[model samples]
Target: MRLYKIMIVDDEAEVRQAIARKIDWRAVGFEIVADAENGRDALEKAETLELDVVLTDIKMPFMDGLELGAELARRKPNLKLIVFSGFDEFEYAKEAIKLNVVEYVLKPVNAAELTAILDRVRGTLDAEIEQRRNIRQLTQAYQESLPLLREKFLLDLLRGPMDPQVLEAQAERFGLAVREGAYKVAAVCDIVHGGEGRPALSDELVPVSVRQMLSDALWDRCGSEIVLGVPSILVATAWERDPVESLMRLLGEVCTECKRILGVTLAVGIGRPCQSLAELCRSCAEARTALEYRAVVGLGKPIYIQDMERLDRTAPEWDGHREQQLLSVIKFGTREQIAAMVDKLLSDGEGEWSDQSRVLGILGTLLSILRRCRLGEEAMLGPRGSWIKLLAEDAPMEALRDWLLSVCLNMSGCMDQRRVSTAKRLVEEAERYIREHYPDSGLSVDRLCEHLHISQSYFSTIFKQETGRSYVQYLTDVRMEHAVELLRATDDKTYMVAEKVGYDEPNYFSYVFKKRFGVSP
Candidate 1:
């Protein structure tokens, strides 16, 4: 409903006033701004005033209608023009057509007829405005998507370690012309804060600032580089002849800037140089390893793959004695002792290693010891009973150490409170397995004992000792519960319920159901 500004032009003031008063210009989506006595004066006002529509009489003394329309068209090509002429000659009509005039109205013009001409001109103006607005909006949206597109491209490149030809094709398509050279992956990360699993809201903008600063600083050294924002680090892929030196220079420049702007120093990690795009994943892994080194090398410090390799040459291999002592505490020590072991593992240099696989192997060893010691509680680690559930490479070391401490203490507490032998845990695990596999007709105590690598006699003794019921009784109880629910909640036949709960013989199922519930099916 926005009104387009209108300008009236004629030799006589009476004619201009009559035209302006002939219609409610506001209702027709046009606003009358000013009146001019001649074409020469109207041209000046049209140029300076930013008028949208011009209504002018053709017969004027200086600079007649056709000459004014042509000059205005050359100057303000977007302005809508309507010509008012008493003479309906071919020359005037042809000249108006050449100037792209929108409408030609005969003067002593009819009010209703001129009003229709003005309405059509108003529609034309509205359409032009809408088209320009749409173009501007599309331009703004495309500008905003550039950063997100760049981030997605970088992440996908590293994840794929994409084939070189495919990588080249994608780079060309996305307008990223990465130079062909050896490349290293570098990451800038915030220092771990207060054992939280992730960074605080105040630190969320740090990665964006880090990416911008690093990309700007490295522009001189590496012409083409990709900076991406990720959860744990601001990842950058820069290609250069001397990648190691480039990474160090990048680290020195950005770390100082981060400290100055963010009020916190950033930890830097640089991966080894890789020759091809296919090797990017390996470089990315090495970069994460370097980042994890902040745990030992100290925060706000840079770590390189070569530095880790040089340190690994002299650092003793896994300390079997220390690992054994740690495992012993996890198996039977008090809560305080277990907590002390976890704190030492994270705070001291007990778990440091140049090879990431070795650290994971040591973690696997800890998990094995817990399993062997019968750590049989769901809440020991987290809601889901998988040990590796929360053990992500990007997880804060302090948080992971806290998790280990809590689980170890829970296991140690269990060992102290009850005679939870391996055999007892075995039987309890069998019961759990049975609950999950109750629909399988092949499930039996013999099969479970075989799977657990224990004698049937020993398994039976501990199964009863732990559960206070025979395995058959426990399985029957689970099946009966399922069958009763199916019977009440479903329209399924008795035979279908029997088969669903692992009873092939429907008659025997009905007999047992009556015995348990004291009712018929």
Candidate 2:
């Protein structure tokens, strides 16, 4: 078992030495880490060293025992305090209770009483240490489940009309690097069979190999997130500038390299760049559309949607069957699913103003669904009967489709706000936990998540997303801040300062200190 460190303080060196020698501290699971001649000296040492218990006299030179105990209690709420005074005054005892001193005794301390106090502190610390171990185990298990969570998140991002706020929050929780830039999504389709004949390769291994190749190529790129897609490997790339030419070149090389090295031909569909992740679904849809043209564009090629000349086909004739399907999806499907159905419903009808009746029918059905859900027309369309004026405005078919999508998404947002609120609350609770428990050296992702009753992967992702820093980084920053404060206030050695701030290893603390502040502790 790890020993609990104890500090002794009194005005006289003789009294301090006598208390230090009175008990066999090590035999009783305590170590005399330091001794101070006065309350002032003890407070300075206590600020520097990580102490579990303090044995002190009530009356001392610069500061009294109750004052020292109050300061220690404020600085380290977990520290156990023992105050000894010759006076049996009621005021002193009342003050000890206010300061939360653990033990009170007459001066010329008794060895047996001190030993009992040390034992109680040890038991308390041991229980806490065991709880921390359990937290570590829970956190480790949660971490092991992250791969599946990541895959799910990536799938959602692809099939998205995800709220941009939620998207960024979830992305951060998953440790994905997202920024404001040109975002384009690429889909990698395996053509080993479609290219020539099926290669003598395992179907699973093919995607695994392709994903690895994509990672290797993308490692130095601006920023990228890749996941094994349903039928293709999906990659989302963010570049600081328009990367149309650069993306084509890189994916074209990936296709060639796959065929040359693995004897597998790959067809890559590149989407047009958009300004934000919110527009990735549109880009993703376009990429899938480009892949469909591989029959005419040729197999085993990298297809860019921007380079395609789409045929000016008219919107499909809406039948009773299609209208019901759209209504059903609008009522219950995800925002992505609803937008996709709407996009298909509006396609090729760009200049067909005569299709206004069909558009109105779709909007009417949506308004009815909102009404069924107990939502007012104004809640979705911004005014009680403004949808009529909107239709009368003679908007383009594409613009009308976008407006319809917004109506469907507005309802979905109402249904989904509960989840967003939950995520925000979880983040708030986590930040509070970290700030309060930074002194515990074992404070970690597992411990924090366990406290929040959440999975490690989720807490890790959302914490990073909300704070823009990983848990480990954030904890280190908290520790470093306290370390700096102690260094500035007292002449404590580097190792003592390290102990005070939760680092077990002084050298490691110095390394982190220098990295964060450009100077050693």
> Cα RMSD (Å) per model?
32.1, 23.6
Q: Give the number of the best model, judged by lDDT.
A: 2
Candidate 2 residue spans exceeding 4 A from truth: 1-146, 180-185, 188-200, 310-521
Candidate 1 collision pairs: none
Worst 10 residues of 2 by lDDT: 309-318
Count clashing pairs, candidate 1.
0
Candidate 1 lDDT tens digits, 230-314: 5555455656564564456456546644553344567776666666655665666556655654543456546664444332223
Off by over 4 Å in 1: 1-149, 163-165, 191-204, 223-226, 311-521
What is the lDDT of every predicted structure here?
A: 0.63, 0.67
Error of 2 at 309 (Å): 3.4
Error of 2 at 10 (Å): 89
Q: How well does candidate 1 score on lDDT at residue 257? A: 44
Please give the lDDT score for candidate 1: 0.63
